[model samples]
Target chain A: MFFQILDILGTIAFAISGVLIALNKKMDPFGVLIIAFVTAVGGGSLRDVLIGIQPVSWMTNMTYVYVIFGATVFAVLFRNKLNYLRKSLFLFDTIGIGLYTVVGIEKGIVADLHPIICISLGTMTACFGGVIRDILCNEIPVIFRKEIYATACILGGLTYFLLREFMSDTNFVFVIAGIIVIVVRLLAVKFRISLPSLYKDKP
Target chain B: MFFQILDILGTIAFAISGVLIALNKKMDPFGVLIIAFVTAVGGGSLRDVLIGIQPVSWMTNMTYVYVIFGATVFAVLFRNKLNYLRKSLFLFDTIGIGLYTVVGIEKGIVADLHPIICISLGTMTACFGGVIRDILCNEIPVIFRKEIYATACILGGLTYFLLREFMSDTNFVFVIAGIIVIVVRLLAVKFRISLPSLYKDKP
Candidate 1:
């Protein structure tokens, strides 16, 4: 039940983020919708494809489509008012990534993939939507720019497996792992922590 | 025998294109290899996923991996000399997209999707590798701009269905359609034809 709510909320939050970017880019309405939809589901679709899941989760379920559509309308209509709720939206976006990481890890477990692959899947799911959004907006992906976003998901994925050894209940591990992701992301932002740039000076 | 040869040549051409872009971006060796691999197989993988084919085509076959690796090494080693062979490489790349459009349409037909959807799938397969390459290199996708590249693929896809009505042999349809794609693309480039920009100045 908790997971279900989180999933819908995440979809909405991500869609709104995409809409904001599209507006900033002065994209047409069709472009805005496309960006919003891709931002909401691109990561999950990529994960499904990588893990050999056919038809993908979203195509089978139409709720996400409706959520994205509604969120797109809401964001586009209230673009000017969005500044007032920026902080709240950011919180929801952070929470969405935390939940998304756990869900992606669970999907990887179901596929019986390796632990490292599972963690990578988790990070991809939690972050690739933003990557797609950035790509569509013609910017380098923030995740590739030393942001702590994907790293938080990786940490959460590791925490899930570590807790699995002592905890028999899956829900407990899921909740704790999600909390870990949220905490890591919050702390990283608070401390302005980031990865080092890979580019080096030629001379 | 024919199809296999086309596929390998296409892979080599796409990988080399990726290598050229990566070198231009001054990306490191690892980044160069990654871009090459993604450019060679990204389009087909996307088509497979959208049509519900699991694990994507490249993940199951190691041949693509080998081909991309070889192509990347060749391109990197001969970077300075590549200028001489640019025209030859362009021909191969054009042929690659021609074959790719037909392959993508066949996959869509096998899935029993709508004809329009199949055409879309065909165009996507022929163009999305470059889109992924541009995204990874941090730029607006060339296909989305004034390029006539995707339009040629769309025309090829339409030609496939048009030929299918009277043709009993699938291979004939495939070959004719592929040829149409190649011819259209070659002519467009030769004549310097391109789509007009959608963005316009406010009156």
Candidate 2:
């Protein structure tokens, strides 16, 4: 129940983020929806493929398409109104990361992979979609550049496992971990915090 | 033995395609290599995932990395000589489409899917990387706009199935079908031939 709700929210939030980025880049309606679709489900799609899931998650169900299309319409209509999204975009982005991380980890657990792989999948599902979206938009991925993005997912995933061990209530564990991730990501963005670039020779 | 040789040639050709595209885009040296790497392997990687292959082909072999890097260095040093690419690029690209189609179809066969899925995978493997590369470069995919792109793979794959049913020597089948695809694509390019666009609504 908790997961289903979080999954939908993550899709919406990620779609919104992608749409805004496309708008910022002056993309058309079709292009904006492509961005939104990739952002909302790219990582999970990749994960499902790696783990050998068939027909993929999104192709089987049309809800994700609806979400992306709805988000596209919303973004196109409200594009001018969203001009000031530059400042508060991180808040919505945080919720996306947190929710996607949980869903990815859960999917991994269901697949019965090793815990380490679960964490890796969780991190990827939380990050790579945005990376794909940004790259296709002709920009460096946000995770590669700023905001301690994947870091928040890793930490949150660890916290998820820890809470799972201590608290038998799966509902409470997921809720707490999800909130922690969102809060950490929010603070990271609020403070403009980021990791040191491995290749730090450039401005 | 034949598929192996074709696969290696296709990898090199795909890498060159990527390197040239990145250079044209004015990416830095590392950036160029990364783009080339992804472009060369992206279609196959995507194909593997869609069909539920594990570890991803590039990740498992690591040789794919070496192939992309080698091709990148060669392309970079000889950038000024790419006028010759207009001459040889067609041959290489056709060979790539032919080889990739075979490999994609084989993967689907291994996964026990239907003939339609095999054809789709073959086409995807042959064409999807270029689609991704063009999208990342912020251009509409050249294949989607240009002469004889996915059509080459579709025809080549059809030839493959026909040859497989009539003959058992894998090398003979791969080579014959490959030449057919290369000839078809080259003739089309020489004639400036193409299919109709689905999105063109103009009267």
Candidate 3:
């Protein structure tokens, strides 16, 4: 029940973010709605498809679709007022990623994927929606370029596996792991930390 | 047997194109190889996942992996000489999309999806590899901007369903559909046809 609420909140956060980006790109209403839908469900759908889940989770459950639609409408209507809620939006987004990371890791574990693969899946689920959004908007994905976003997911996934070995309560481990992801990202952003550049300065 | 050969050739074409792009970006060897692999199989993998196919096609068949690797190496070694083979590369790419479009349509048909959805699947299979490649290389997807590429696949997919109403031979239909895609794209390029812009002049 708790996770479900977070998932819905996450979907709302993702959908709103998609709307903001699409509006920024001056997309038509249909395009904005489509982008919002894709941002809300793309990662989870990708995860489900990868593990061979039929119809995907969103198709089987209508809640996410409705949530995304509602969020898009709300976001579009309140676009002008959204600046006042930026901090709230960021908090929701952070919590969304934290929840999504653990959710992806759990799905990978269910599929019996390797630990490394699970970590990858976790990071992918938490990050790829933004990646797709950026691609459609014709910008470099913030996660790939400067953010510590995916790294936080990876660390959380690693923590999930590590905690599993020591903790008997799986639910407790899940909550802890999710919190770890959220806290790490929050701290990283607050400290203005970033990953080292892969390329050196051109001579 | 013929389709399988074309599939291999298509993989090679896609992989070589990926290498060319990665080289242009001055990516290191690992980045180049990753791009080639993604370009060769990204579309098919996406299709498989959506249809709930486990392990994906490339994971089950090692042939694509070997082909992409070999193609990447060959393209890198002959990079300087590749300008002379641009026409050949273009032909191969055209053929690749043709085959991939038909293949995706077949998968969608087998899954008993709607014709409209099947057409979307076909277009996705034929064009998304390049879309993903451009996304990774931090550029707008060429198909979305200036090409008649995906339109050809959609047209071919429509032809498949239309021909199915009269044709008794399934293989013949497949071949015709593939040929339609190739011919449409060839004609579009030769005639400089393009999709009309959706946005009006700002001024």
**Which predicted model would earn the best lDDT?**
1
Give per-residue CA lDDT, model 3, range B1-203, as digits (tens): 87899888888999999999999999999999999988888888777778776688889999998899999999999999999999888889999999999988888888777676677678778888887888789875666556678888988999999999999998999899999999999999999886653446531
Q: What class would a CAPRI assessor give candidate 3's docking?
A: incorrect
Candidate 3 clashes between residue pairs 3 or more apart in a chain or in different chains:
none
For model 1, give the TM-score of chain B. Answer: 0.95
Candidate 2, residue B163: Cα displacement in angstroms equals 3.3
Candidate 2 per-residue lDDT over residues B1-203, each given as its tens digit = 75566677788888888878876666555446556866788888899876667657765565677777888888888878977776576567678887787778889888999877898898898888888777766688887766787887788778877888999897688677667777778788889888866766842
**Runs off by more than 4 Å, candidate 2:** A1-48, A51-127, A135-203, B1-3, B28-31, B191-203
- Clashing pairs for model 2 are none
Candidate 3 per-residue C-alpha lDDT over A1-203 given as tens digits, one digit per residue, 9 for 90 to 100: 87889888888999999999887776655556657977877887778876777656665566877798899989988899999989989999999999999888889888999999988888888888888888777876777778688888988988989989999998899899899999999999999987877779831
Q: What is the DockQ of each candidate?
A: 0.17, 0.13, 0.18
Instruction: Give the per-residue lDDT digits (tens) of candidate 1, residues A1-203.
Output: 86788778888999999988876776655556668978988899889887878666765576887789899989988888999989878888899999989889989999999989989998889899889889777987877866689989999999999999999998899899999999999999889887766669621
Which prediction has more favorable TM-score, 1 or 2? 1
Q: A58-129 in candidate 2: lDDT tens per residue?
A: 999998888778877876787787757744455656777888888888887887766656776788798889
Candidate 1 stretches greater than 4 Å from native: A1-53, A57-131, A140-203, B201-203
For residues B1-203, what per-residue lDDT tens digits would candidate 1 score against the true structure? Answer: 97899878988999999999999999999999999988888989888876688678989999999999999999999999999999989998999999889988988888877676677678778888988998899876666555568888889999899888998998888899999999999999999986543235521
Q: What share of the true interface contacts does candidate 3 keep?
A: 0.31
Give the poorly placed runs of model 3, Cα more than 4 Å off.
Answer: A1-37, A50-52, A57-131, A135-203
Considering the two chains of model 2, state its CAPRI-style docking category: incorrect
